[model samples]
Target: MILKCVAIDDEPLALELLSKFISQTAFLKLEGRFSNAIEALSFLNQNEVQLIFMDIQMPDLSGMELARILDGKKNNDKTRIIFCTAYNQFAIEGYKVEALDYLLKPYSYEDFLAAATKAYQYFDRIHNTPVAKSAEPTATQEFIFLKVEYQLVKVMLKDITHVEAYKDYVKVHLKSKANPLLSLTSMKNMEELLPSEKFMRVHRSFIVALDHIDSVAKNVIQIGDHQIAVGENYKEQFLEFLSKWMS
Candidate 1:
């Protein structure tokens, strides 16, 4: 399916480059391009854009500001957003807006592809499902909210990198954090919480997020900067996941 897309940026070259990229891309269908948020807002009011390539800074309005306005509106399920910016300061704001991905300035086609592919997959996950789950899904379903020392935390199956079995307690590693925040839990209890589609108990010591993986080589799996070892018994399942997804 073609993604109905829009680009909102004041810079002419930025707009040109995005349009140029979208023209070459097979899946993205550009519905509109606006120089500023005013024009983009008007377009958004009337049209249904499934994917947005947005800039954070502009003359009269900012992308973050625009996203805030969009956040208040009701929209269809398949819509996705990717923030385009040179500044790293806006990353937190982008996350607050629930952007699918953030693109640093002068992004290459490969970077664009990575972001776009994620958006497409997200759209598929949302629309292809028989029943749509809430963005902030229920607490009672499967995930646990655990207290580590004094702080209580909510752990989602999708964000988990791995759960390390250490004697009686297991360490939970989740996504979107600068460092992994470990909580006291058990492998047996946590395993039951994970969605079968997104996670795999690859080893007795490790359970991995299948989508967050960066690469797999021989006997190890790379999730972003960290490397997790694949046990002897789990090598086959690990290899199959890598083989199916890796180009």
Candidate 2:
């Protein structure tokens, strides 16, 4: 799926470079380019672009302020934003507004591709996958059908040991299978499908099935043959689960 995107930057050279990067990417299509945020916002009001490459600082309207406005809009289309700025101070703030990714100024084509690839994977799942509708987990729902290539493979929730993020896809580890089931979806998608009561995200790249945990030591969880490290961001929640288990 091609993502229709727009770029907004006050710098003529930066805007041209960003547009060039967008054009170099196979899955991204540059729909518009604006030197200021006001014109970009006005164009966005009428256009349905899937992704935006924006500068955080601009005259009249800042990218952050325009993002806030876009968030409040009643339109059905949700456009993901990637903020490009010289200042690194806005990194945390950019994520707070739910920007897809932040690019530091003078970024390489490789860095640009990484951020754009993330957007492509997100849109690919939204437009091409059925997991959004059929994979919603419930208390009694014990199984889910995962799209693998052209066929839907039925996987029992009880058999799941953990879900591992494999680049753009996720590996659904199961007790019954010799190898994990590879699905063309994000870790976020898998987390949404698995019952939260039974599964917990121990790390950004690993979600462990509470029932299948073999051991825990030094912030690492052992499930079967795999040892998954607990990320610092997730440590508090994982420890809370442990405290409950011990109690």
Candidate 3:
């Protein structure tokens, strides 16, 4: 599948490099290039692209800010983001916006190709033909794939105990693993993808599996050893959920 893509970066060299990479990739078609997020936003308003390769730091509007805006839009799901930055600290923040992948600056062609391949696979899976789509999981889909360290890993929904948002990534707490599976994705993305009947976002940074919640006290949810506090914004809904089973 040929993915229509755009590039946004404040640095002229970065934009040039990204453009070169897109040109070399057979499956990617460069639709636009912007030196600022403001212009990029204007372009996005009028056009639709499957993927975006954007730099994090920019004048007036940063990539992170732009990502949040895009994520909140009506057609937000139509576009996927791949963040390119020089700073490693923003990795966790990138996932918060549900970025498809993170590309550190001075990356090689191979690195760019790997990320593009992921975008292609993602678009193909979601926009498959009728027969193919029919064969895929329905609303009761039991699992999802997450990009971890540049590779996609299949995670069983039932195995997840909770998901905690880190700085730029999310830690998928699982019952079977001693340590959480760290993936480059946002909690919002996880929340939307998960079955609402089974998962609930108790905090801005936390999503807990309903079945895995052992107890709730003082507006805090206990799952295994984790004590997750329900955010003020989410407390009302969570209490309503609890009322259904309370004596």
Top candidate, metric TM-score: 1
**Winner of 1 and 2 under lDDT:** 2
By summed lDDT, the worst window of 10 consecutive residues in model 1 runs over 138-147
Cα lDDT over the full model 3: 0.86
TM-score of 1: 0.57
Over 148-234, each residue of candidate 1 has an lDDT whose tens digit, in order, gives 544445556566776677775567777756656665555654565555667888888888878877877767878877788888897
TM-score of candidate 3 relative to the true fold: 0.54
Q: lDDT by residue for model 3 over 1-247, one digit each (tens)?
A: 5789999999999999999989877678999999999999999999999999999999999999999999999877789999999998999999999999999998877567667766765776566535446676543455666668855577788999999999978999999999999977667667766768889998999999999999989998999999999999999899999999695
Any runs in candidate 1 off by more than 4 Å, and if so which? 132-247
Model 1 clashing-pair count:
0
Clashes of each: 0, 0, 5
What ranking of all candidate models by lDDT puts the best one first? Answer: 3, 2, 1
List model 2 lDDT by residue over 85-192, tens digit each. Answer: 999999988987889899999887756765776676566555655545576632245566566664456678799999999997789999988899887877876776
In order, the Cα lDDT scores of the candidates are 0.75, 0.83, 0.86
